[model samples]
Target: MRETVRWRNAVFAVFFAMGFGFASLAARFPTARDALDISVDQLGLALLGISIGSIAGLSTASHVVARLGTRAVVSVGVVVVGVGLAIAGWGVEARSMAVLVVGLVVTGLANGITDVAMNLSGAANERALAKPIMPIFHAFFSFGTVAGAGFGALGEATGLGMGPQMTIVLVAIGALSVVVRPRLVEQPIQPEDHVGFRERLSVWTDARTWLIGGLVLGMALTEGSANDWLALLMVDGHDFDPVGAALAFALFLTAMTAGRLAGVPLIERFGRVAMLRATGALAAVGLVLVIVVDDQVVALVGTALWGLGASLGFPIGMSAAADDARMATARVGAVATIGYVAFLAGPPMLGFLGEHLGLRDAMWVVLAFVLLSLATSAVAREPRTASGAPDPAAEVRP
Candidate 1:
């Protein structure tokens, strides 16, 4: 149990670092745009670099983890993230859009690799702990985003540019990664678990896998759209200043953190399907409020609801994909790949829509996806046991 606790803590640290690194970039999006002197549409196209790199990373993460193990992949992912941040910072300082795109691509790849590796670690730990702790792990990620956005806001208030701000964050994340790497469990893929390359590619044939991936795609869009656009939306759509926009973004992250922390018990009581349905409705309403309502206070409330609604989808999808431990890595990779398509396609699509229809109107695209998730929530039901009975032991509890 003590070792389990240690491994859990280690995995939490990795998730936190990943969140911090990503949020550090996210929080600085406005500054990055200004430095490059680009329009919203152009920024969206450039941000596609992240999606491209992430797709590449997700495509190969399962195979890499199978060979190099989770710890090593996570460690390498940290270094890659740090380097990517530095290059991104340099791009901003140099006022080079090309450099910035390259940096974002690198950061996205690292984010993808670490995302799969650490979630695998988290899922293994969840099985060992025999509790519904994936939400808590995701909560730490929200906490990290909260911290990163808070610091970014502070840096912006103090007139610090992206370069200095990211440098400080990169150093801190690098140090934390070093501290936690050794403590991660060395759970390499077993010999029997290994399969031929053709067999490994066969996860796509599973309908359940694609259903889960579809759910995650909706969640990822809901979450990623907010992460990439909320601040900009406030500024462009609502006529807020930079500081106010950052505050709104911070509020979103805080609300998400709260929801995830509160989610474990709710999930324990309601089960994954019911909880997801409830939250999905809340998120849809929140999006309506943000888009249709004219008042800032009401819109901010909508943002909070949106955050709370989106908090569980990605984590729950990950948990569902890993329900069968034997095929966890492959399923996770496929689902992540399918889900991240939202991330890849969302920015450019929204950017073009925002350019034509206005940013607030562009967000209406998310509503369709959220409804899709609600319809598919049943796919996340707990796995059945050998006798074809729903496995009570597999139901996660707080």
Candidate 2:
């Protein structure tokens, strides 16, 4: 019991650290673009490095985790993330596009691997606790992003250069990882249980796996769109100043974080399918409010609703993916890959559509995806057992 408690706390810390480091880098995007003297389109292309790297990393994460175990993969991955951060800082200071692209790729690769390993660990801990704890683990991630963004804001206010600021932050993150390393619980894969690449890909053939991936994709895109464009939406659609737009975005983040923190009890009571459908509907309503309403206040309310609605989907989807302990790694990795492709690719796709339809109209695309998530929510229900009851042991195994 004590060990479970420790592992849970450690997972929280890992999620938090990952969130902080990623946000710290993200907050510098505008600064990096300006430093490099790149056009917005150019910057988007540059950001594709992260997408490419993440795809590569996620594609092989199961194999890597099988060999190294979650603890080693995540620990080493965090340290690598720090190294990537330093390189990105240098790229920004030097204004070298090639270097910056390489750095982003490295960071994305590390983040991708770390993301799978940590979530697998979190799912394992959830089994040990026999409760719905994944949402709170993700809530800590949100907390970390808020803190990291604040750190970046402080640097901006103080006129700190990007290189020095990232260097300082990454070093701290790396040191924290060392402290976090031993706390992560190990999941041993027996030699016989380990499979080759072809066997691992079998999860890809499962209909339920694809359905769960669809649910995750929609919810993830809903969240990712706001992350990438919410402030801009406020500014462009509502005529808000930069500060006000930022505050609005902050509200969205706060609502999302609060939602995650509050989700587990709700999920436990209502069950996964019902909660997913409910949240998907909420997100759709929020999108409609923003897309159709002209008033700024209405848009702000919609943004909050959107955040709240989008909050639980990712974690719940992850929990669903890891439903079967024996296939946890492959299923989790596959589902995550689908969701992340949405996250990384959705924003730019919206940017493309936004050019023709305007940002507000472009949100119709998101609405469609949210409805798809709603439609697919049923698949997230725990698989049935021999007696046709929910598999109690499945939840307990990972």
Candidate 3:
């Protein structure tokens, strides 16, 4: 149990670092845009680098973890994130879009590798505790985003540029990664659990996996759209300055943190499907308010709802994918690959649409996906035991 606790804490640190590193870059979207002097559509094209790299990483993460173990993949991936940030910062400072795209690709690939590894770690820990603690792990992630966004806002308010801000932040993340890597309790794959490559790939063909992936895709777009574009939306759609826009983005992250912190109890009571459906409704209403209300304060409120609604979808979907421990790694990787398409790739597509329709209206596409997730929420239900009772191990309680 003590080792389990340490392992969980290590996973938390990894999640936190990942969030902080990603948001440190995301919070500078406006600055990156201005620095590159690119149009919205052009910026979207550049963001495509992340999508391309993330897809590659997600598709291959299981193999990488199998070869290197979760501990090495996660630790090395975090360090790679720092390297990518350093390059991205230089690119922004140099005002070279090509350099920035290269940096983003590197960052996305590292993020993809770390994401699957950490979630696999978290799910394993959750099983050990015999409680629903995945959301708490994700809450720490949101906490990291809150801190990163706050720092970015402070840096912007103090007239610091993206290059210097990320330089200061990435060093801390790199150090944290070094410290936590050793604390991870690497779970060795048993011979009975070992599967051939073709067998591993078979999870991708499962209909239920795709259905869960669909749900994750919608919620991922909801959360990631904000991560990638909320600040810019505040500037372009709502007429806020860069500093104020960063604050609004911070506000969204804070709400997400709160929701995730509060999620385990709610999930323990209501179950994943109901929670997903309810959150989807809340996210849709929030999007409606943000798009149609035309009030900055209302937009801010809508942003909070959006964050709350998106808080659990990815984590819960991950938990569902890992319900069958024998196939956990493969299924999680497959689902993550599908979900990341929305998280990483969808934003650039939205940027192109925003160039034509306006940023506010492009959100309607996100809303459509949210509804799709809600409609497919049933797929997240826990699998029944052979005796027909809900699996006791899957019951998450205090």
The lDDT values for all models are 0.86, 0.80, 0.86
Q: Write the per-residue lDDT of candidate 2 for residues 329-363, one digit (tens) a residue.
A: 98889998998887578756776666556778888
Candidate 3's displacement at residue 334, Å, is 0.2
Could you give candidate 1's per-residue lDDT for residues 244-346 as a string of tens digits? 8888988888888898999889987888899899889989999999999988999899999999999999999998887766677888899999999998999
Please give the range of 10 consecutive residues that has the lowest summed lDDT in model 2: 187-196
- What lDDT tens digits, residue by residue, belong to model 3 across residues 252-302? 899889989888998878888888888888889989988998899999999
lDDT measured at residue 46 in model 3 versus the true structure, 0 to 100: 84
Could you tell me which 10 consecutive residues in candidate 1 have the lowest summed lDDT?
Answer: 187-196
Tell me the RMSD of model 1 versus the true structure. Answer: 1.8
Model 3 vs. true fold: TM:
0.97
Q: In candidate 3, which residue pairs clash?
A: none
Q: How does each model score on TM-score?
A: 0.96, 0.91, 0.97
